[model samples]
Target chain A: MLGYIDKIREIGERLFTDGKVDVVIGFAKGSMPMMNEPMMARSSGDLQKMVWDGNCGINLANYLTNRKEKIGIVAKGCDSRNIVTHIIENKIKRDQLYIIGVPCKGMIDRRAISKAVPGEVTEVIETRDSIRVKGRDFDETFDRGDVLQKNCAVCLHRNPVIYDELVADPVVEQTGIDRYEDVRKIDSLSTEEKWRFFDDLLSPCVRCYACRNACPLCYCPTCFVDESKPQWVGKGIDDIDIKTFHFLRAYHCAGRCTDCGSCERSCPVGINMRVLTKKLEMDCKDLFDWEAGLTLDKRPPLDTYRPDDPNNFIK
Target chain B: MDFMGIERDRLHLSWISSAEATKFIDVVGEVTAAIKALGPNTNFVKNKAKAA
Candidate 1:
């Protein structure tokens, strides 16, 4: 994945010189290790600053919402899926994007690395199958597969589903992965146990809204949390309010989420809120046999209605 | 709601025509019984004093 930087720059430079795009949205090295930030390059010089590595986990699709100018976006599998969702929802026109597709190998879980290391990490180096972490007092290496972000570990669509250009050949997708094991465990719990489980899980949240802000699907102008007309949720750290916020946010992403893990990646509290969204994703698959952003021709399950749709829940 | 630990029986949805008063009464009785079986709603009920 480190070798993708030069190819990205070459494509971005050509796009700028040809006047084919107004900006190229990609990733630049972050000030800290394992924290790459999204960059929008307007000139060829800015393209040189772009880089790609396992640390580039932030979804670039979050930057594409409502943009009017032509964009040359560097999209991984998840980012491309979200871009397809954007196009399906009319958030951005498909024609305005020139997708430079990347075959993703998965992203590193910085939190996992922090937990495994004894001291504060100062540098991270990755090869094809392993990662080396360097700290002030400690240096360690671990198998890359062991520290991948939870979603990426179970990812099935590693190659971009939609693209105008390819940076490299599509990588082989993973198989035989049980994607809903956690959701099933929760499903088997009693009502009281489940409630207690979520209560403990969400106790660390400070209502910072990082999960919501990091989500590309959370593009509503007046989010329900902020609306004063009906005052749907209180702006406090109350347990019930926190649960309500997470529940509603998960509901909002029901049939649209692509499991890009942006919400979990951006969470300051390290909450795995993807549990909520993934449950809904699993239900969408079980009931409607659907996956979000795989195609542009059909509407999402929740967005459309049919006579034969599942009605067992209606009694 | 069920996935979040809320009892599935706590909420009910049914289709009844406006003129079918007997069906509505029967459905209401069934829904009431289901809620009664689930006991008091203790999970999501916001504590007003704590929030304030």
Candidate 2:
């Protein structure tokens, strides 16, 4: 990943030197194995610590959503989509941000790594090519593509859809992998079965709000659940409260979610939160035939209506 | 007026995909035409006195 490091250093130096940005938010080598830590560099000296490689999987856009300061960011395909959504929703100003777009084949999942090689993974060594995990007795070498996230298997874009700088040559093969099949299968289930699935899925949520906090699209001045007056959802995980949380989150994200998949990745309990957004994505497609974050000029689907839209709600 | 009870000049219909770039333009054209035909959806009510 020397190319990645080189690009980060070059961009960081240029941004700091040119007074283009006050902060550069990128990934630094994490102290823990198989983890990439988010770093905010204020000066060229701190740019030395910035690195990028196969394991820089965590979506960094989640951290940059609300900051008003001038900033630069390292965006993968998914992260770029999140940036587009934020700009469209008027949550962040595009002119204040400089994006260094990097092509990605998808970063490796740390949990998947632990599963593939049981026992203590002392360190992870990743290069511009492959990853080798050092552990008890077995130092397994793996191609970077072999252990990508499930969501990345059918990535729609390898290059950033929007960027000011390109770190590497784009890998442009638009794989037509439909993401709605899982949502469709779940949709076909009986109402009872659906209830059972949600019951199982949300039971583990400790109301930590990590998923909500980590989402870039969830930038609201005041979240409804946090409101004390007529408190929407109580501070516990009952069936009703958990169901309300997911429903409200899904409703709030209607026509606004870009399918960045950070909410799913941030969940410590491993709830398949992508299922919620995937279903919302399907609804937006089927009803309004609109996808979020592609453009800033158009209004969101739920915020507007046509005279001849489906009239199923009429009495 | 058409057989489906919609006036040809008054009605607009479109089929679109999620990724289509030009569909928004099509929808906006149709909606603006429709809105011009029928007045705005809401009117300004400065107060209850204005409503009365």
The lDDT leader among the candidates is 1
Each candidate's fnat? 0.85, 0.00
Clashing pairs in 2: A1-A127, A1-A128
Q: Give the alpha carbon lDDT tens digit for every residue of A199-232 in model 1.
A: 9999999999999998999999999999999999
Best by TM-score: 1
lDDT of each: 0.93, 0.75
Q: How many angstroms is residue A72 displaced in model 2 relative to the true structure, after the best TM-score fit?
A: 1.2
For model 1 the interface RMSD, in Å, equals 1.0
TM-score of chain A of each: 0.99, 0.92
lDDT of 2 by residue, B1-52 (tens): 1211122344455666788768867787876877688654221112232232
Name every residue pair that clashes in candidate 1.
Answer: none
